[model samples]
Target: MFWKTILIVFSIFLSILLYRAYVVFTPDKTIFESCLSSTANHSLKFDQNRLRTFQKLLQFQTISYEVNKQNFDEIKKCRNFIKEHYHDLVTNYSEFVDLYDIAEYSLLYSIQGKNLNLKPFLFSAHMDVVPARDLNRWKYPPFDAHTDKDFIYARGTLDDKGNLFAMMEALKEYLHAYGQPSRTFYVALTHNEEAGHSGAMGIAHHLSQQPFGHNGQFEFVLDEGTTILEEVFPTLNNPIAIIGVAEKGYMSIKYRIAMASGHSSMPSAPTAIGILARAVDKLESTLQPSQFGRGPELSLLHGVTPYLKFPLRLVMSNIWLFGPVIEWVLSRKPGTDALQRTSTAVTLISGGEKENILPTSASATVNLFNDFSNELEKSLSTAARKEPLDTTNYLACQCIVTEFIKIIRYTWLSKKDSSLEQSVFFSLNGYSTLNKMIELTVTRDKPVLASER
Candidate 1:
């Protein structure tokens, strides 16, 4: 009787709609997002001191977010603390300058090298971090920078502050002892990378005029990126560190719908909530096809083929033969599947203010990472339902009001070079290992997306 009751309840959605045919074929039923790309070579020395400093840096309440953006006071406090602690390095080791006049938001520190013939190297990290809320859920106060014998937890612990402080401390040590190396060092710490990057905007404007800032040749730019997963892929024994040598393009679209408001007891033909829900579900369900056979992800997969287990390795080695099957398998997990296609994320939805009354209007926001070869306009046109399609297969193949969110250039995970292309993977050894460790075990599954050239 209980089994029957459970079946009856489950039948509501099962009868209404079920997953597409593709998901059923993906076996192993384990999480695939934890998988990554790496070689046996990645190595960075572990240090308890670095972890301690990260905890101290995390203690600073440098919370930055989009809405209710300004937290200038806390930002200044963090900046001042950095200056005070690293006074010797700031005053003697290099040229320390503020990129923004407003509470020292964006910052740049430069250490000139002995040999100008070798190109300079750039290291970048954001000083600001996303706000940590829901205090009750946190193991420790989000800004308290709690540290156990092994783990360090805080607001910016993983998002960025840990990165910023570690670099600064390493820079101070390097400059204090060895002075300068062959490649020049440009350390850039922006004020609010978490919120909108006004600090970065200011720094860019500053770099535009200077001869070395933007014009000078650099060995390679180092930014946040991919990690090394030990064995998420049942096939690999060695950890895989996916270093991004390039990045993807991005765009955002907003949709809104309007309808007559009414009480729950009396419903209308098509309510605002119903219209918006249908449109979003349709937009996502009918997404673009996977591009692993040709995309950058294929390049990384090809590189990792030598490390995969026997049968899987054989399959991965010849993607030309097994491309569709592999896509079907990986595409079930958004984290890996999205890497090969123009990914879409329906982030925000807003509608009714009250439970009893049906709202008159509703809106949804979608963020998309468009493949480099595809145009946003074309992708939009393809995704748009209005231009004659099989109406029976999808949600109302019609849309209402739409808006575009104008965005500044933001850096994310970079692109991996294909077998045919030249790569900058070995350029910055220090950061390569540091980044590997960060994403491998420390940062978990989060990796920032980036643009190459």
Candidate 2:
């Protein structure tokens, strides 16, 4: 009887495994059906003057040095440069568009829509670039916007100015093609995103004071975050854009130890430095518990699992059973490891003065990027249950993932050559992929919000 029971249990287990492998792991073509399709406007060719304007915009030294000490002159020049280059937007469309200088350097363009009932969208980009500290490491001058046969080499070419320029150009193009949009939208360009978000906060404060800010009534807000990643997944052949649903929050813990000082010749059993060192070592050795299959990364993995090859697809699809194995593998690499759990980094440590004397005090600071997905989930669920109409609570969590595409200067590729299979990634002829989003959405007869995608 016992032998018969064991056989039956084993047979059931085998059946379950087979069912999961074949049924659960099967590809679902409909998964990304809601994602935005590349529209015809993506093929629009940018003129030489527009490319020149992009290159000139990159030449500005609007570097954020410190919170109080920023290169304001360069920022002002950049703002003026934008206005001068897009003369049509400022002069021709002055009635529909209103420009405001928030926190002195930040620029906010409020474009009025024909329909007042539609909730406006907000798009944000930062103007200032981090200082180019290691000039010797750069192949070209950091601010030069050097154009080779393929790429434009500059500090802000990829980060934010690229997005900013693309947005402005898209707006101008929309006006020329479709005229004033049916849905209202706002573009906010902050001057000090790298150093501090004061400019952003100023704009936020200004918007909050307006009538639309009452219930967070906007359609959606798109801000700068992660870029498009190529070869992010090992088994997947295609590049995936990471719309960051949310960013990891961080906390810092500072440890300080104080002990009696003595000569090096006669040391105590545990000195202050020794105690601190051991504590730091323990913290380093013990990692935070992995939160795999719990966060937005789970959503990401599920979305991409069908595209991944063979065993990986099977493994990702059956995360409930293979989570520990996948977690172990993911934890091996720093970049991939961060996606699995909260990460710890000992950024600062200091202790002694002279070699002869024993240190009296020692301190260490450990920074942790917390996996706050649980908290976020709860907040989202609560907001949805309590107030379905008020989407302000949901705005912070929605994000876009896109690859940092190559920006080809002065050269435009044909539609056939520019396909993803050719691996061109995208070009700046129309406004690259990031900016093309704005162009496609507003220009379409029916506006498609990023959240819907």
Which candidate wins on lDDT?
Answer: 2
Model 1: per-residue lDDT, tens digit, 186-269?
677767665553555454444444455434545766755556677757667767787787566555556655555679888764
Worst 10 residues of 2 by lDDT: 434-443
TM-score, one value per model = 0.72, 0.72
| Candidate 2 structure quality by residue, lDDT tens digits, 164-281 | 9988888887787677889898888888876655575567666666666645456766666577788887788777888865566533445455556689999775566765666667
Cα lDDT, all candidates: 0.58, 0.66
Q: Which stretches of candidate 2 lie over 4 Å from their true place?
A: 1-48, 252-275, 350-363, 374-453
